[model samples]
Target: MPSVEAGTAGPLTALSPIRLEFAQKAFIVSGGRLLLVRKSASDPFHPGRWEVPGGRLEVEDDLDLDDHIRREVWEEVGLKIDPGPPFHLWQWFMPDRADLAGRGQVRVVATARRCRPVTVDATLENQESDDHLDGCAWVPLDEAGTYDLIPSLRPVMRAFLLAAG
Candidate 1:
């Protein structure tokens, strides 16, 4: 995957500038843990940051936002979400460039139930670099903030608190 230079620049531009586009993905939860990726202790996106599992929209995974979220959970986290009418908890928009060139947004969604955990092939989740992930584990929700996270993701953390209520 091509790494975008960090910024709020609308859209991942390439064929030349002047494109203002954005795609959506989410931070999903199940079994009291929010699935996360550790960016190889060497990636630029978060470089060792603990992040909600998700990625960009692709033509192949044709579905609405909710289905897209469900698909991403399986693809990135190795688990399937229950019959969920998943709702958006919060959205993190990339910082704007001039400072926005490399900017993107992530939406975090909390699911109601955790699926049966199954042994998964780690190779499937390798979106960018397999080295990016040190390991996968079910981490507690409260412990989320204990790890490095993008600024936009902060508010989504509150959803954990609400879910516990």
Candidate 2:
């Protein structure tokens, strides 16, 4: 990731006025299978849907994006990854309840990175009491599309499969 120094003139400077949230998702692969986690039934956004491990970047996190992703992966699924460069990028706008009094929706920009697990052991430990993730599996890459994934992730899965082939 590149940063713009304060007062520097560039095309990205125009984005200063907009509030964008950054998030990272990992496609952790091992033994021709991809990891997926099921969102809890009570999750407001996409309950019961399957998604890759990762989450939004918090302001308090380390400046390094890779480190931030590593932390999120560990926290979400109890696994370590060697994150590769982002293979896909996507964004969506949703109502921002925190800023409902002012702006109605906030744009969430996210990157889906290709990753490899540090070890062949793909056993997942999802702490149900701590987060919305309730279950996990290492699905074969060719059979991934049959699972009910979040809407935004469908194309990502297709692209990944094609690329992996």
Candidate 3:
């Protein structure tokens, strides 16, 4: 994965290559812990590893970026989100790993937000439950590294936690 320096200059102006694509994501943080989902082992791209729940932007979504993120959050984690604008845009470089499967290496340009928390109920659970994840959890940012995480998301979680502060 590409490691761009993230301090004073921020991420976009950091050492990024030209091949990045914008993928909207929700940080989904609450009480110092963030929500993450582990994709099914059978799927491609960091399958069976923990990462923030999100996906590519769809064309007919018709909503603005914030609405897109709010929708994506519900779709992935079954939780309602109150987005606090965009905190940061992070560039993640995915490498070819065992779990990466048939997906090609690419840059994941992500825009993030801090979301309001809510309880996840059975209805919400059923709506958002996906085959990609074997399980999901809310882990503290510091402790999240210990989980089996997608290689590219490690820095993203860190970057947002720091940015949120």
Residues 1-165 of candidate 2: C-alpha lDDT, one tens digit per residue: 567678886575544234679989999998889999999887878899998988888878657898988888887888878989899999887767676465456788999999889854543564435458777899998888899999988898888888999
Best by lDDT: 2
lDDT of 1 by residue, 1-65 (tens): 55567664435443234323333434445566666566566664566666565554455664665
Query: Which window of ten consecutive residues has the lowest lDDT sum in model 3?
Result: 121-130
Candidate 1 residue runs with Cα over 4 Å from true position: 1-31, 86-132
Local distance difference test, candidate 2: 0.82
Which sections of candidate 2 miss by over 4 Å?
Answer: 1-18, 100-103, 120-131
Can you write out model 3's per-residue Cα lDDT over 82-158, one digit (the tens) per residue? 77766667676665343334454556677766666665431225334343666678788777657876776767667
Instruction: Kindly report the root-mean-square deviation of model 3 from the true structure over all alpha carbons.
Output: 9.7
lDDT of 2 at 115: 89
Better of 1 and 2 by lDDT: 2
- The residue-level lDDT of candidate 1 at 30 comes to 58
Q: Per-prediction TM-score, please?
A: 0.56, 0.81, 0.66
Rank all candidate structures by their TM-score, best first, as comma-separated numbers: 2, 3, 1
Q: Give the Cα error of residue 76 in candidate 1, in Å.
A: 1.8
Model 2: weakest 10-residue lDDT segment is: 121-130
